[model samples]
Target: MAADHVDHHEHHPHGLAHQFEDMAQQKESVLLGMWSFLITEVLFFSGYFLTYLVYRTQYPVAFAEGSHELDITMGAFNTVVLILSSLTMAMAVHKSHEGSKNGTLGYLIATFILGGVFLCVKYVEYSAKFEHGLVPGLAWHPHGEHSPQLALFFSLYFGMTGMHALHMIIGAGLLIWLLVKTAKGTYTAEYNAPIEVFGLYWHFVDIVWIFLFPLLYLLGRH
Candidate 1:
């Protein structure tokens, strides 16, 4: 019994939680938890999306006019930046699997920088809207037909984009924490659950932006 216990202890991966039977089980548990959390997130965002669709159907022209007020060029640039961040995030997870600490750190830093860039672009866009007095219920002064409907469009725009930005901000905070852990060599081939789970979250954020870009920036632009 003593020898058997010693063997089992040796086989156990580093960082395995006491409650988990083994590394595989622990990884599965963490991944499932993250997926479950993401499902809730999807539901949360769905409300906004549904509202946008319903309102757009009722006020198509107003929505289009509001979309035109958006800087499509900046929106497109941020989309590309976010897509690149997703790539880097994936690469970081791959490096973690390989136990390449330096590789993981480099990619994670790149992802962080890209995320920052996206947020900065969003700040610029928001600043412009504020300056132009387009914020609904705050400084709304739209210069076109259907002023009231335009306010509705801006309301949805801020609500959706603001929520997206909040998620990005949270992701950025997570990245900073991950970067510190990664730099300290906390993750490795036998225990990279955090990195993998975070990758899923980061990818979800990017996918949200993919939907948002077309809806908020490209809609009715033709």
Candidate 2:
């Protein structure tokens, strides 16, 4: 009977560590985990970048022309949207830490909308490429007597950007999960580790775009 009573007491709400203590441990673990995951992400994307480098070195002119085919305006717009979403995600974390549940939800919703807008822009860009027959490994060719290296460029472009888009989809799913948790009052002024971790992920995605924009759109432009 005493052993059962002890187990019941241990399961009591306050039996858990205090919120701040929990937050500290949670933050440390999450930061470590996020950095570890980011290292893997860098390694994963590096293969695509290396392939692009090899092909571009082999056929500079074709790569240049292929790069020109990309819509800089659309790419720039998506960059802006991603940056804004990062900002909103940061704000969501901040609000969570401040115990402002409604504010957190609002920022999260804003981030989601921005993410949707980014996807819409991406869709338009991809459709244009499709119409131009720029798909990788399928119906891809340079327009109007361009270098065959353009095919290689398109291949890398599709592979890398497609992977990035997949990451964005994952990020969106994570944000939705965070939203659900937020609605459940899982985060509070004293306990918001999940928000911080999600912020790290969102920012990492934004950082990838920072590199991607320069590599895919701006390179060989001037």
Candidate 3:
């Protein structure tokens, strides 16, 4: 009987760890770690954005032409998809807070599906560009004016968006892992650090897209 009690206590969410006095402390630590990581991500992407700004100012016409060639419809669709996923992710966190395990799992699944849809749209857009020889350094040619600057524009476009997509893939994988934990009944209202951390990551990805859409799609749309 004593052994069984110890086993149950070992698995108790409130038991947590020696380092954390309570679940709230654990959640706070996780949140701080995520913010630190995101700060580094911001610094990393800043280099690319600065480069884009420099070149866009130098060759405004070429940048405008290249931007116009992008499929704004697809970009807009992806933006919507990500925003919806962010909402679902936030709802999942809320469900966890309310101690609704099933609701949390459902929201996680919904967010994952939305993320998949966004990636599929991205694939279609990229493939279309490849077929049209719009890719940089590989059969790229400007039909109209500003042919030379098209390559530079394509370079920045692919680099920035490709990095963002990679981050999305990582975030989706993390959420899936969190969902698995949720299925195993590892979270409760008193202990949901994982869900909250995942929410922070989802929000960060959404914010990145908010900036990306305008810079890549709406450049000189006027």
Tell me the TM-score of each prediction against the true structure: 0.94, 0.88, 0.91
Clashing pairs in 1: none
lDDT tens readout by residue for model 1, 63-103: 89988999999999999999999999999999999999999
Per-residue lDDT of candidate 3, residues 10-60 (tens digit): 443653877665566777788899999889999999999999999999999
Task: Name the lDDT of candidate 1.
Answer: 0.94
Candidate with better TM-score, 1 vs 3: 1
**Best-first order by lDDT:** 1, 3, 2
Candidate 2 C-alpha lDDT tens digits along 1-222? 445432223332321344424445656877798889989988988998888888878888888888799999999999999999999999998999799999999999999889888888888999998988888667766466654667778888888888888888998998899899889887878778778888888898889889989888998998
Number of the predicted model whose TM-score against the real structure is largest: 1
Residue pair clashes in candidate 3: none
- What lDDT does the true structure give each of the candidates? 0.94, 0.84, 0.88
Model 1: how far residue 131 lies from native, Å? 0.8
- The full ranking of all candidates by TM-score, starting with the best, is 1, 3, 2
- Using lDDT, give the best candidate's number: 1
**Could you give me the TM-score of model 3 versus the true structure?**
0.91
Question: Which segments of model 1 are wrong by more than 4 Å?
Answer: 1-12
| RMSD after Cα superposition, model 3 | 5.5
lDDT of candidate 3 at residue 77, scale 0 to 100: 94
